[model samples]
Target: MIQQTLTQLRELRLSGMANSLLSQIEQPATYEGLSFEERLQLLTDSEANDRENRKQQRLLKAAKLKLSAHARDIDYQHPRGLKQSVMASLLQCHWINKAQNLLITGPCGSGKTYLACALGETACLQGYSVKYYRISRLMLALTQAKADGSYSKALQNLAKIDCLIIDDWGLEPLTAAQRNDLMEIMDDRHEETSTIIMSQLPTDQWYQSIGDNTLADAILDRLMHNAHRIKLKGESMRKIQSNLTDGEHLE
Candidate 1:
């Protein structure tokens, strides 16, 4: 009878439940205290939880976040800029649900990318699809996709994601083609999907970095409005870590 039940569970693709049942059979004492209905309920809950865990794993794998960052790991102890209240609000993910943008600007190693990845991880944990890309690499990939005649398809895929994290925005001057490509991406995602941009340049200098006046305005119009801004103000986090390491070594 138990073998038949295991076969039925395997056929139904309830592997989690099947495994739980097998464990119970292997060590009957483990579940001897539970009633029949309680045992069934426990197995059912295990199956549901297994499915959720697998789904979350797939989403996190696809997110491609640079750091293994989480909302809780955010360093509020060493003041970067914004208050804990601001981070708490953002962590709630209301902005992502509302299809807004988030801009994180600061000098190199100022923890901008880390914070962005942390938010991206949060989005993933919330069951939102996410993709991470450095601006230069992303443009290159787009250019190659265009060469392969998959540019339209690429944009469509990006448009469907719940959150898009673009690191190193405005790192270099943009060509006309790059400007147009960026405009298309911003236009497609605007008011539809959320975006997180990490940049070293201040917001005011973005227009100059974008190069083409008209296209620059169009891109910024889509990104800047209806977006939250976070400017990290402090020395490079790397330098701080290095100093801490030196102190530890001396001790």
Candidate 2:
């Protein structure tokens, strides 16, 4: 009878409850003291928790973050100008809920990408949809989507994400087509979702990188309005953490 009930629970897709019941059956002494309501509540809680864990895994996989970073794993001792107070507020993900943007600017290897990915992971844990893209790759994807006749659909999908992390911003000058594509994406996401932009150049220099008078103005207006900024300043963390000997440098 117990095996039949377990089979039924699995068929109904209540694997969490089924597993919990199997454990209860194996250790009857542990759960025998509980009332029927108490046992039922435990099964329900286990199923809910299992569902939440599965959802988080799906979100993280779909996010495609470059780094496996978490908010609690951020290194505060790295001396990269990261403030605990600011990170504390950001970790709460209230800005994402408000559809605000985050700009993280710093020298290369200063952990900008890690911090952005960390915040993105936090958003995923909080049940927000996130996607990460390098500026060049995203431009390529947009161009490909245009050629494939799915450009509009791509833009619509991008607009629906709760948090979008754009890494390596301003690495190269933008062409006219890429500029237009960026304009479309930014316009779609403006004031409707959150974005995290990681750049080596400072914000003021982004205008020159965009290389257009009119579109640059429009893009910056939408992107920078009410956005939170984090400017990291320090030596390359990679250099500091390297195990390579100074005398054994590779060409």
State every prediction's TM-score relative to the real structure.
0.91, 0.97
* lDDT by candidate, in order shown: 0.90, 0.95
* Model 2: residue 130 alpha-carbon error in angstroms: 0.8
Once model 2 is optimally superposed onto the true structure by TM-score, how far is the C-alpha of residue 242 displaced, in angstroms? 0.7
For 132-249, candidate 1 gives per-residue lDDT tens digits of 9999989999999999999999999989999999999988877889899999999999999999999999999999999988998999999999999999888888888785554577
lDDT for predicted candidate 1 compared with the true structure: 0.90
| Model 2, position 136: C-alpha lDDT score | 95
Candidate 1 vs. true structure, TM-score: 0.91
